[model samples]
Target: MILTFCNQKGGVGKSTTLYHLARAAVASGRRVLVVDADPQGNTTEALTVDVPSDAAGVADALSDASTDTLRDVLVEGVWDGLTVAPTVGEALNAVRDEIANSHRPGWESRLRRQLEGLKDEYDLVLIDSGPALDTLSTNAFTASDGVLIVTQSTKWSLDGLALLLRTVDEVRRYYNPTLEVAGIVLNQHEALTSGGKHYAGELEAAASENSLRLLTPYIPKRAPIKDAVDFSRGLDEGDYKARPLGKLYSALLEQIMEGTGR
Candidate 1:
């Protein structure tokens, strides 16, 4: 299962979702691969166990198309079951040159094709996308079997979702027909303030009104989320268990696996 956590909008917790799921999946005795397609490298920084240069990272992987090749230098996880294809800061800029001269319509499909050759070695593959609707994300959609979109419950976010869903539909029709929008996750949910409950309620009402069937599981802001990130502890670690965000992520993971069979 290649699940891409995506949203063109930044600060919607794409990297957080990817890392949590990947970390949890590994703890559950699954061989997981993480493809960090973002230029920010937040996922890489959070998960890095070793230092690998950008020149020797993605460019080489795309150039060789070899599954067995040692592409990403940072390799971690229990028994080496978690593999990471983290983007170096250098690869992001260089890819522009490569993509410009490339001839394919969806030049982004390179990552997809690469993962196709490597799918059997792992039980799940998670991709963290950048904050744009560029060719990279198009390629991510092409390579992925499903997408898990994270968004806060807000009017502007609700509006932006229409465009995202349209893009997902187009990608399905043209590139990967089996690609599914497995779930829409509500992040930063809290019922403390009237405004909070109102906004979340409005979102839930809109989803039902539109027959969207958005996932019931949700995530909330918690101190440990920041603490975990700052301390470099993956969600599978016990450091996060006492926080609300930890339980929320655990429920979200269960909901995703049940909904998408991840």
Candidate 2:
């Protein structure tokens, strides 16, 4: 299954969800390939060892066979059946320009083509998209079998969900018609305060109060979540502290294994 974690806004746990989910899927014994579609390279750095000088991850992977291919570099190992088609810093803005030039409507199919080439090689392919509805997000969504839309429980964030739903709807109708809106997950939920608890409660309450299907048992705000990995830190120590993130993601994975039940 190809699952894209997307949102059109930043600071809403898009990368975090991708990181934890992909790692959790790996820990769970699934061969997963991660596509880091964002230019920020957050997912790429988190997963990879060191960076090259040029850092044209997507360009090297897609446009040329001689350049260091993302598939060859990342997919060389079978870690718990997980692989990655990672992105490096400064990926082709050319993709944006090319999409603009092509009057054809298959821009979203690019990732699909790449994945089809590697389909027989893995069990699941996960695409971690940027927090915007750009060409990258389009590729991730169109290439995916379903999407896991993440949002912090806030009025503004909730408002943005409408636009995401619309975009996925278009992908379903036109691009990848089989793309399913798997479910919505509420992240960083906190029941400690009235405001925090209220937002969390509203999402939990949404199912009974409306037609919307909300994923059960939302992910709460854990302190380690916002902390970036200290690359200089000892590898073993870093692994120990990051356990909470893994556990949280494993729980989310378990819940996702359960359907909407509508």
lDDT of each: 0.71, 0.68
Residue-wise C-alpha lDDT for candidate 2, range 118-221, written one tens digit per residue? 76676667788887787778877888888888887876776777678889888888888888867777887766768776776665565445445577557778
Expressed as tens digits, the lDDT of each residue in 1-262 for candidate 1 is 8888888888877787777767667766788888877878788777775555633554456542334333443366322468877677666645645665777675767777677667888898888888777777887889998988877766556667778878889999998899988788887666686766777888787667755657766677665665676566754464535444565666767777887765
Clashes in model 1: which pairs? none
Instruction: Name the best candidate (by lDDT).
Output: 1
Relative to the unseen true structure, what is the C-alpha lDDT of residue 180 in candidate 1, on a scale of 0 to 100? Answer: 89
TM-score for candidate 2, please give it. 0.83
Q: What is the lDDT of candidate 2?
A: 0.68
